[model samples]
Target: GGPRTQLEYRYVGYAPQTVEVGNRTMIDVSLEQETNELESVVVVGYGEQKKATLTGAVATIDMQDIKTPSPNLSNSLQGKIAGVISVQSSGEPGYDNSTFTIRGIGSFVNTSSNAPLIIVDGVQREDVNSFNTGIFNNIDPEDISSISLLKDASATAVYGAKGANGVLIITTKRGVTGQPRLTIKVESGVTNFTKTPELLNGVDYMTLYNEARRNAGQSETYSPRDILLTRSGLDPYMYPNVDWIDEVYKSFSSVTNAHLNVTGGSEKVRYYVSASFYDQEGQYKVKKMNGYNPNLSYRRYDFR
Candidate 1:
């Protein structure tokens, strides 16, 4: 008969509600606190703030999403975060950390780097791309609570010129209001190249060389007898066709990571302590005797 009316109410911290006013003289409504994801806390360049209140671009990642078996935390950031490009140049055991660029490349100089500013627990770190003195790779992924990327002008505003490139904030887990909780994780895995390069063996390499010489109207470097000898792989001292790849490198290597962390405390004094162990073997090998270890390996232990 009459046009129906409706009322909607919403607030920043409270849930939104919609009510219809039909054939009712009086209506009572109760509003409860809203659990908005925008209200979740995130670490910024200087401090922490709610995502809803942030002016610049900020991206956060869940700890569960980055729980990878990789020894370097940067390796797990690939494909997980937006505007973040991670390029892993090598799979070397201890030097496998990915090169990170937020949004895009931050530098044009060859000597300078394009890595984002890495801050751990409010302390500024030198460089994430350091292969010799790498501090970022040393950080255990288990101890990290959250990682936030300040990806725009807000990044520059927070830390001045240093943040011009981008800011990668890593917040470690702190004590919470509860009993002492112990977390132990032991993971073992095998690391390997996704696709091993197929190289031409001695026979193929020699034959190809001879073919190229004939095409160029030049004398063949390898003769038919040489090709046959190489194919037969006889008398390595004379007609040697060695598979250097197989001799110097293995098919795959093993990796082991173990973490032990404890978090607990009252409202007054909170505490979070952790110890982590990481062992990664290189995909390299050499001749050895006397039970000697001629294998390249990297081992690290962290206490925080």
Candidate 2:
């Protein structure tokens, strides 16, 4: 042999090749280097759509967002979605309903049913006012898988008759492809009036009354013993400068809720079973009000 020779290679990617001379042995492997980015797809009513493909003006509320600071389903939707308005007509416990509208006023003369249609898990839920006795509690927000509102006519045309007003499509939780998944959610918090009114004290009340009397030029030194006693603090119980509103209202009301969900299975039969317990009290009112709502739900989904 004349002299020994050495070969060197410099490259960024694999390229299989062979350098041969008189007699030599070599093996090479070429592999395509790739960078892949994974994405999630959400299924709307009619077809499958990527999150980015949505352009028809829609709002999505998921389960995790429901189980947060506020347990009120109607409160959760307040100002969260664009072009949607939720007005809570009353502050009474267990009596809150949201009036949902789409793209301002769709009808010029029809105000009877100005609200958008509400569909829960493919079941139409109209005439909610008829059931406003507070007998039925709303769907547990924690149990909701997703809430999608169809805002424009183009998105609402699929459901035709029901979509004339608008669409509020609610899909409940379901099972995934895995072992049985269990989710436990618990929330406890106080409920207080946003702004409580202030009533006049007894002294102020008498002062106002006497001032009115003076203004009217009635100079009869009106001395109702009850008023005199109240001014003198003679009988605190009988003429107490009591805050009747505070006396009737609680220092703070409370609500506690707990729910458990069991889900998951194979391809054939996937199921979701959930139960919840809720106890809530009123914020500000003359009488005390509390509620207990125990719910059980079962759903079987077939992937056909």
Candidate 3:
């Protein structure tokens, strides 16, 4: 024996390999390692921190969880985050920004400050509401990569006064090192009311009204003949029984959305481009004097 030789080497990676040769063994070995979930980095107020090291309360919204179509990005956050309440105050065309509150209502004194601070790409915005008319639309949801809600004082203290109501950090998608990729998505559908109130017809409405009037010690406004005339579709011009609810609401409204995205880049330079169009028609149809009926329609064009 050549003075007993021993050698050892250690490496951390996937799989393990070993080889021995002659008396002086030469060995090659590899060790597998597990990923530490705590090491995952998350966007915080002013900076990023590892999830495991963060002591503040935070909640992340999964983009996949947003399946419904919405005019404003805030509307998509409904029921997606825990301890966060998102409410669409109105569905009016181009003015549908959902109100969001973190950890419940923090202040009733100032309604303006009740909303969480929205930070997009490190820039702070008062709220997602759009004032320029048209369904409070701002920021295309397709461009969003991640949304993190910063709760608790520890995480929001970095933002000073702005963070008192909490903070929402929105990160847009970035190009990665790979071949150029193009994605086009098209969605078209109709929206119908989930539930409609049971309404009375002309005769039934008159009957109920007359009964109520009689109970209140008043004379009946509609006679039996009047009810029959309104019910029969013949004297509409004189004794009209309009179904206001049916006339105001449609059976279904159309919605169409299309988005195109292109992304590619190298280590030095990366780029992401996206274009989208959204068109939605409201259920309410208004007839113009020019014999044209137009539904409350909203159209939005987005480019990034």
Best model per lDDT: 1
Model 1 Cα RMSD, Å?
8.5
RMSD of each candidate relative to the true structure: 8.5, 15.9, 13.1
The sequence of per-residue lDDT tens digits that candidate 3 reaches over residues 1-304 is: 3535444444532333444444654455565553455566788876788776778998877778764677767778888888877667667776766776666655423255676777888887665433442322457788888889988898899888888878889998999778999999889988777788888888888899999999999999999899888889797999887878898998988889888999999999999999999988888867666766566678889888
Give the worst 10-residue stretch by lDDT in candidate 3.
Answer: 128-137
Encode model 2's per-residue lDDT on 69-117: one tens digit a residue: 5435656667766776556566555555544555664543224366667
Model 1, 1-304: lDDT tens digits are 2448888878755777888888887889877776677689888876888877877788889899888788778898888889877777776667777776765544532122566778888898876666553688888878888999888895558688777767888988888978999999999988776777789988889888889999999999988898888788677879988888888888878889999999998989999999999999878875667878867788999999
Q: Could you tell me how far off, in angstroms, the CA of residue 285 lies in candidate 1 after the best superposition?
A: 1.9
Q: Which stretches of candidate 3 lie over 4 Å from their true place?
A: 1-36, 108-110, 129-137, 213-219, 287-294
Q: How much does candidate 2 score in TM-score?
A: 0.70
How many steric clashes between backbone atoms does each model show? 0, 0, 7
The lDDT values for all models are 0.80, 0.61, 0.76
How does each model score on TM-score?
Answer: 0.76, 0.70, 0.78
Residue 87's lDDT within candidate 3 is 64
User: Which candidate gets the maximum TM-score versus the true structure?
Assistant: 3
Higher-ranked by lDDT: 2 or 3 = 3
Q: Is candidate 1 or candidate 2 better by lDDT?
A: 1
- Which residue runs does candidate 2 get wrong by more than 4 Å? 1-42, 51-55, 69-72, 105-112, 127-137, 224-228, 236-240, 283-304
Between which residue pairs do clashes occur in model 3? 93-135, 94-134, 94-135, 94-136, 95-135, 95-136, 96-136
